[model samples]
Target: MSSMTAPHPIDDQWDRFRSTLADASQLLLCLDFDGTLAPIVEEPDEASPTPENEAALASLVSASAVSTAIVSGRALADVRDRIDGPKTYAGNHGLELSRHGLVAVHPVARKRTSRLEAVCTALETVLEPVPNCRIENKRLTGTVHVRSVPRRLRPVVRRHTHAVVDRFGNDALEVSTGKRIFEIGPSIPWGKGNAVALIAADLPSETVPIYIGDDVTDESAFRIVEPDGIGIRVGGDEPSAASCRVESPTEVATVLDWLGSVGVDLLESDTSELSSVDTSSFE
Candidate 1:
């Protein structure tokens, strides 16, 4: 996990990353939905991609050499509805996936749906007193969002939430933490890493995979594409498996913009060096 930050237009580290993208025959561009594409809002339902990011993503998706996918913690249908361009999506932390117009849910996760419902039901009862604590039951998985909860009572929310989930036992469900949320899902080994690899499997062997995300849950994905592919962590100086780090979703949009413009040039036989791209404006 070599962490580097950009303080100028385009640093040497970015140039190297661009070089890799320039030489690739094909690219599988995968991104996490919430913090990666859209701003993480207090109300989860309100989160959507910024106009610039959305348009840049549309450009990448329209490219002949790029295949785009959104891998998210949101439910498959939910993320698909929120993001309209990408035909491939992995939701519920990869418990459900839609690719090539076919939808698949992990068999174990499907079977555990009833148990998850029961857990959520119990959680709602115990968490009712916590202000602004949202319990989202996404069928295959669930989340207890405490981002808007009063800071002083957040511990109470976590304690009560875990107590209810503990009653269900580890075999039936598991808990994972993110920025300010606790995700409760079917107890399984599958995650974003497995989901990314599964999606990459269908691509050409030479296709370079680029995954950008901003969550602890996304670490699995960062590790999955290491050594060869690129893993970019967004908005943190925290130690990560990601090879590169960017400050915000705004910078992410710049990266996407560069890919759409410069990438097209390189692919179409234009070998001219990319002019210095001013990233300082984004900061």
Candidate 2:
């Protein structure tokens, strides 16, 4: 899962999402970082999933009929570093897709590295006058890192990013805004939703997809899903495309625990129902 623009209640919404997973033949747990699992940080590199969240997700993945993915707009390696190499990582929207044993590289990325390089070049030139600002190349994206910059300079930074990218091409590159972080990337039509949809069909069975995320980038996941699939937005007290919302990353973990519980409940209930049924009649 990716992120969204607005905020919504991510807590107290677990039951709303349980039907999507109850009795599901398979469950795909798709998640986002930065406000979803890990709280946003001044330094992107410093953002790490809390040990509890990691352990919970690890446990869920180990459970039968479940798979996991950490999808983020952050570069693949960077996300890998944070989650420490979880299976099924999709980085830079859907530009890079990888699982432990399989990998899919977007063809556009091969032709588009230079475009990112060009954006970096332009960023270096445009941001030269702005002190306390840094331009970063994530290979697939360019971030005008202003985390260290004073709040007053944000407008100046945003203006410079728009001006530089406008110099050439169409909307082939994107500028995404996050908590004090603004990024530009190749204008490609891929994102978390696309990743989730692709991964969903490839699972061994037709599974329920539950996406968890916080950020505008995550809206991609919020938009794509079948009738049985669910998008769990992690943020504010407002409404969104996501069927339900939770308040924080901790709540996300809580909801996941709830999902595990639901699966257990379903298994137990099925067992009890079967026990009550007389099998000799059919035999």
For residues 72-179, write the lDDT of model 2, one tens digit per residue. 888887888888535688987767889646667788765777887888898898788887788778787767888788788889999888877877435667687865
Worst 10 residues of 1 by lDDT: 270-279
Instruction: Flag regions of model 1 displaced more than 4 Å.
Output: 1-12, 267-283
- Per-model CA lDDT versus the true structure: 0.83, 0.72
Give the per-residue lDDT digits (tens) of candidate 1, residues 102-162.
7888999999999899999988988988889899999999999999999999889888877
Error of 1 at 244 (Å): 0.9
Clashing pairs in 1: none
What TM-score would each prediction reach against the true structure?
A: 0.89, 0.83
Estimate the overall C-alpha local distance difference test score of candidate 2.
Answer: 0.72
Worst 10 residues of 2 by lDDT: 266-275
